[model samples]
Target: MAEEELQLEDGSKKKKLFIIIIAVVVLLVGGGAAYYFLMGSDEAVSEEMTEQGADNDSDESLTSTTVKTGTALYVAMPRPFVFNVPGSTRDRIVEIKAQLMIRGSDNEEKAKMHVPLIEGALLRIFSTANADDLATEAGKLAIRESALKEVQIALSEITGQKVVEEVLFTGFVMQ
Candidate 1:
């Protein structure tokens, strides 16, 4: 009789421990779900607010240098610029596909309208670059900066504002 009572008591204790563990797991899962849903809703609300704020803001306040907005516009050249330059051993042909980054749609239109001039200026700059110089990363960067400056100057002369924020070489090949 005593042994039977001991067995019953042990069984009861095991059942109680199982119940406690199950409760803990349930609470943890529920808490995690709550946290996830709450955070997700908050982020959605914040994103909507940001969109509304952007819509409310006007473009007139944007200066030539104030491109602190979240968006950047890219305008690709219609054709690649291909030329030959003097390399260390022989003449190397270089082909470059370039793009311009501008702030607003107006600037983008202006840049598109002046594509011929921009291409001519860039080709003039690229023609002066030696194949040996362009073979290195630093040389490429220098060429890009020089091209950016020239494009900015050209656009500024026409628009009375710097239209292009950056000049990027999207594709480059040398052979």
Candidate 2:
């Protein structure tokens, strides 16, 4: 009977060990998935950057024509962008007032129509900028360029043309 009891104990221990091994494997898989999601794919970002660069390159001639065709127009936002940007140590609040430069009444109207979409994209871009990125002149310039690219991309999708000539900041403050 004692031998039988010892055998049962050993069997229970084997079952527990098997369950522990399965749990560890599950945990490892979950960690890998999380890491993959967080890191995403650099290839995707590179592809987008290449596509936008190509679009901008091809539109250079068209850009000049649009400028010459009509009086330049600037559309200002109803309110400044106010948001918090994450940093290594803490969060910083940033406010930016910007104007969109376009040409002709049609593009102006389209720009006005897509204000919300433009704002959404800008907010996404702005929120992702860390304090380190906002603190330096070069970083700020890069951020501005990124903001312009995002606006142009959004407008291109809506109007089937690059409606924005430039994104000029009227006011910028951070704390």
Worst-scoring 10-residue span by lDDT in model 2: 60-69
What are the per-residue Cα lDDT tens digits for candidate 1 across 1-175? Answer: 9999999999999999999999999999999999999999999999998886676455543223435454579999999999999988999999999999888887888999999989988988998999999999999999998898788777778877878878999999999
Model 2 Cα lDDT, one tens digit per residue, 63-162: 3223335778999988999999888889899999989888899889999999998898788788789887898988888888888888877877777887
**Which candidate's TM-score is highest?**
1
Q: How does each model score on TM-score?
A: 0.63, 0.60
Query: Which candidate wins on lDDT?
Result: 1
Reference-based lDDT, each prediction: 0.86, 0.83
- Residue 105 error, candidate 1, Å: 0.7
Alpha-carbon runs more than 4 Å astray in model 2? 1-68
